[model samples]
Target: MARPRAPNRRATSCRCSWTICIEPDQGTRVKQRPGGMPPHPSQVLARRGLVTSLTWLALVAAPTVAQAQFGDPGGEGTAATDTGQIGAAALSTPRYMGADHNRLRALPYLSYRWANGWFVDGINGVGYGGSPTPGLQMGVHVGVSPDREESDDPALRGMGNVNRGAELGGFAHQRLGSWLGGKLSLRSHLRYGSGEDRQGGQAELGLGWGTRLGERSLMNLGLAANWANQGYMQTYFGVTRAQSTSSGYTEHKTDGGLRDLRLSLVVIQLFSPTTVGLLMVSQTYWQGDAADSPLVQEKRNTMAVAALMYRF
Candidate 1:
């Protein structure tokens, strides 16, 4: 004969054996448990509620996240644990795409990811992404397209502003293998929006190599080329007869093709398990119709950024 098992109290009871509460000055405190038993169901629920409330509070008070103009630095890896980060960045870049001068600005950064392949990021936008296989990730997102202001450069005295608008896009990243002790990957992106008629489309393909520098430091190098459709080329690089007369420039017609090439280097340092710092430098070269436009005061552009982030 076998001995009978004890009745399960947890399945029958909703009463908590212990209680936990947060104090403003002392943080979380737990009441004594009578028998050193596991936390009751109500206690577990209360803990979850407290965590949710704190996370929401942090998001509301934190600064906005940084937007990466080059490419997302960590998009090629495997699925990540649920986490969130907030920070700020100092950025220096051309006022406009073809401007010869640079402008400095301060930007905020925030991002959050879930364990089930969902993320809301300043760089990648709000989207669901996952690795169907090891080393490959694909996803789609909706984001805002950048706008150009005529007042940003003296050369654009007559050119009107290109208003910002929404864009729909998709991205794919694939880790190829190792090269020179670094991880090599390829990435591609395509999006449509933002033009005089809001039909401009663009695509980019790039290669990236990343390596660890030390116990808490990493570095990445990237090179990419961009292609544009007729709508995009014409809106940014073409001039009409009426506008040519007003701006004292020749009326130029543009056809879609290769637009520009970019090269970038980024370094990241982990200050602690919960804190990080980043530095990046990049250069861009305009070609084809984009370079031929009279609006292009300079065909080469440089940009730099420094940022600090806190993870939770």
Candidate 2:
């Protein structure tokens, strides 16, 4: 009886005395801080990050704008102070020709950017084909790039005796777009070498793409279509006396199913003015006619050079 009486008293107290704060009444308003002030640390950090990001964006954009105006020849406006709206070159060709495949060589080149979108290059190779023929070669190359500055990479000239015999001609290059290019050149090796005995030549045309591999190299690939030229084809796939006549030390000859291919790799190492190292390779495949003479079934060539560059 006593326990039941206490319970009854506690229940009555719970129903009357329970007190938990509920949400404010509907439409009730909240109070202001009395005075606006700076936000918390998180808010401040977010604002600072936004400001920092904007600053970095501006810094990145500034160089692009500058390059557009004064530096990139492939770009527009011709803001170069040297050109003064006339649009001139920054400097002459930094590289010259020397003998890599033969005993002596003479490679002459002339390149110009016309007012029109097209660019022009003239090339000539003079020498006795391995013999000292005093031969002549002349050819021309033309193409359009976004601008001339885009073609400034020196590694594009792979290893080859561009002019073989007494021929007259030049090499040609054209930029089809930002990522594609093409070239053609023709020559006649009428006579080359100390004997001055042989006579022939080939016409050449090539298409290629400029692309990046990984983050370390710039690459170029020329297609089989370019070698369709008879002259160019022969210059690459043809067998020379050097190949036909065995030195006894090494015998080499060529076979059938002629082919010529070139690939180049360039690496840019950033230092003071930035350093560039290049590797260029040329390969030729010949089929048939390989008898007694060590004909070249395959010919592979490689060149490596490192150069320091600065642009003003």
Candidate 3:
């Protein structure tokens, strides 16, 4: 007669014995005597939580990876493990459109790839995009607007806060082959914000080129045009009759059209297989009604960011 195997103390009493060894050579085993037994509730909950986190990470990592690829698009292959970057960025931005109080803020930068063709970029928001090897790719994304508080600027003392709200959108990218010894591309995205008083939309169009500087460095340059809808223009730039009476500004009504023209540059340096550094500079020229609003004190805006990143 064969010798009876030891019972698994972790498992409930059952007639059938199961010996599951992940690696028999290593003596790793998961033994259970219950054939019809379901996974423990804690195990099930842990698995579900892990899956949800990974999905969220993927959504945030894809855009950042795509940007780091510098138009190369070769990193989209499916993998068994998740990869991600964690970092922080120091950003210099205007308190509002024209506020003189420029604030330097440190923001967390995170991105993750749970699998091929899926990523989430914390700075750029969450989305899914195809591999860069395809030359043509599209994605859907969601982002949140920055909070506008009355305390950010003296001019905004009575304007109250433009509470941060969600923005959902889609984007498309097309590689236009090599030009100037770099990959040329066209990109566009349209986003709609959801807010009771600020539910408005904006659109962007851009042309860009990216080049590899060396074994571990890359650079990109782009020019973009931005457009806004009437609702968006009104929310940020318009002063209503009541607001004018309370804020001591003339009542102003505005129509939406061209919002701004932007020129941007990004440089990335890879310190190791798992570490990176990035710098971005962008200048915006406000146009039309956005420039004409009393809230807009400056027609030209400049922003810069420096970040250090690590991947796993």
Candidate 4:
């Protein structure tokens, strides 16, 4: 009985405490919608101003991108330089570049010579054998006479025909007193035809002559000057790879005339009766003809000739 009575009281109390959860703050009065869109002018104007400012910023930035990507290299405002020479100090005359004032020279020379060619008088085989020879001729040195005969050297020497091609180099005749002398020559020749691309060799020989130039002796050496008169001059001295091509051909060529410049030494072994000896040297050609046909140019040239002359 006592337990039933307490239970009944607690049950009634629990039942009464079970109330509805009415959230008072959550059920606040709702603000009614403005009837037919009433205007807020200041807020609208502020929103409109922000949109306008944003549009202006976008428009200005669009052109700036292209200007940076497409404008000239030296920024937007500089000029180029490759306009010849510049600066006040640089605009000088052509003569200012090198030694233009000093001129070279063509010195004077004197010598007596006797050069004989049976061919000169149409006497074939008259020379070098017991054959009927052409009459020889005597003349003053028939070459560009120079001031120093003992030391002067000249005209380029080629060894073979142009069809064969040849080498180029310097040749010198050193006078070693009366009656004795020697010559120095360096040259090369090339071979024709296909397959074997061979270049030739050079020979430096010594020959002697006894002339009457008193103490100034003279000598005639072996193999003076040789030439090939083909009209074309190749850029190379040999049949180098550059010189040889499938199209590069070698042909028999001629200079029209006998292209021989005999370089010999002669003397008049006595002076009381006006003894005289002659040294006839060929020209040391520069590169080629300059003012004439098939003209060539030269680099530098040095030539000289000395003779002993005795006059009665």
Candidate 5:
């Protein structure tokens, strides 16, 4: 599976409950509340704020920790003190990008950055990351893309399984000046390794904004888009003639283009100078050729996560 990006320094967290719903024009009917009354206006705002907070938390915190240990942000090649973080995280996400169901996963949250720029973590995999110039950070790493099983969803009965494989990728993030009293940044990632053949490739680009909510809290808001090659899209979204014969879905072929768009929110709370808690929520909308695929049971996907970490 693709790993979520960690948060940066300019972000913070908030308190609220979030609800995900498709827009009226999306052709998906909204489920009414038990009383059939729409949510109050304040409730809607709160939910929106919650979403933004979670996305911001995930996007801002991680990079700041990594950069602090790798080197100073000014790219002066200064030798910084060694730092590391260890903890655990739980993630709730869709069984697959377009699956209507969800799954809960436990992940080891660990990262250590040496003064020389090399690092290992459950998030960014193993890589060397540092600011090559002021306001810019880049790195390369190797990670695993988890496999998909037909049993994951009954809808995939005869679609077969995809084996996990090694993926090679690199990432770049740049700080874009402040916006509305918050710091803004742009990030991009590209990798190869997704199908049974491990020949698929994917790319992501996003914008993140964050700010402090208080002495011990922060929040972040982000928007991102994903793209894939023909091999990757076909593997995940396409239904072959044989698959149609068995799965009872029409054969569908997918071509590469814009895949989906995502909006995320994150919130972070500090219990001590070295101990922190993070919560994040995100919504994704499938689009282009991927959306047209028969395997896509839901066009919108929601994901949530919570984690705790200690720095030493």
Candidate 6:
């Protein structure tokens, strides 16, 4: 698979903006604006309202609690914190890239640190890695690639479903000192998916800063870029002549490049010594040919998740 460089564009100059929102429940707040501007008008009305409403509803309907992530945005690996910690989280996200619908997911979070400087986490899937020094960590992980149903979106009327596959990858994290004496981290992930033509892997890199709001609360802000390979680009965004005819979209031949930039926020509140509440929100700005595809109805999208966790 070809690895193309991201085009020189104004979009590359944009940076992530972070805001700290504190509540009595020890919640964290995060909002992202790509290019530091409002979304395109066409997108504002199409999926913005739905995203906002769904997120708001989840926050209100969910129990007042928070959960922890395995390799959190703060650059701290969950296994390094508490070895035997175990918990679960329910996430709400869109079914597909440009879909208007959302789905609910429940998954467990686990971290086990062995005596041999090895660890495994359940949140992002089984992995072996941990923070070896004060600010550096590395690990390898293998996990299932969640499948996508073409029927989820009307625009994908004829596109075949993406089969569930596997991905194995490695990650590295480096701490960028602290923010106001709080911890900050930079992390990156490289993963290869199992597909004949989509054999190339994906790469992600991000910067994050985390702070303790109080004795029982923690919050993190993160910004990252996602790059796709030719196989991946074509798999999801490419439109063949037959597909174009069936899906009513023009043939779009996509090359590997920068797919999108993402900003994320994570907040965790410990309700009790063993119970926690978490809220995470992320915003993405699609770029290059990925955004130019006819299947892409909204170039900018929002994803929110609220979960309650109990550590045993």
Name the top lDDT candidate: 1
Query: TM-score for each prediction?
Result: 0.75, 0.31, 0.71, 0.19, 0.74, 0.70
Residues 1-312, model 3: lDDT tens digits: 933432321323546544221121111123342566443211111110121222222222321111211221112222234566667667677667655556777767566655544666654466665434444556666666545667777887566666767777776656576676676767776768833365777777878776666544666787878888988778777778877877777778889798888777776664654455667776778889878888887788776667776556
Clashes of each: 5, 42, 11, 26, 26, 7
Score each candidate by Cα lDDT: 0.61, 0.23, 0.56, 0.19, 0.60, 0.54
Higher-ranked by TM-score: 3 or 6: 3
- For this target, which candidate reaches the highest TM-score against the unseen true structure? 1
Q: Go through the candidates in order and give the C-alpha RMSD of each one to the true structure.
A: 12.5, 27.4, 14.6, 48.8, 13.8, 15.2
Order candidates by TM-score, high to low. 1, 5, 3, 6, 2, 4
In angstroms, give how far residue 223 of model 4 lies from its true place.
6.4
Model 3 scores a C-alpha lDDT of 0.56
Superposed Cα deviation of residue 128, candidate 2 (Å):
23
lDDT of 6 by residue, 15-106 (tens): 55432221111111222334554432111111101111122223222211111112431223322122344555576665566555556777
lDDT of 4 by residue, 120-232 (tens): 01101011111021111111111110011111112112212232222222222222323223222222121122111222222222223332223222332323222323321
| lDDT per residue (tens digit) for residues 1-312 in model 5 | 922322221222323332222121111111223334343221121211122222322432331101111111111121144566677767777777588988887766556666566666554466666666765667677766656778887888999888877877777766677678776778777778867678888888888776666544666677888888988888888888988998899999988888888887777675654566777777878999889998889999877779776666
Ranking by lDDT: 1, 5, 3, 6, 2, 4
Global local distance difference test of model 6: 0.54
In candidate 6, position 193 carries an lDDT of 83
Point out the higher-scoring one by TM-score: 3 or 4: 3
Which portions of model 2 show Cα errors greater than 4 Å?
1-166, 178-198, 212-217, 224-259, 263-276, 287-293, 297-312
Q: Measured by C-alpha RMSD in angstroms, how accurate is candidate 2?
A: 27.4
In model 6, where is the ten-residue run with the lowest total lDDT? 42-51
Model 6 alpha-carbon drift over 4 Å, by segment: 1-86, 104-123, 194-198
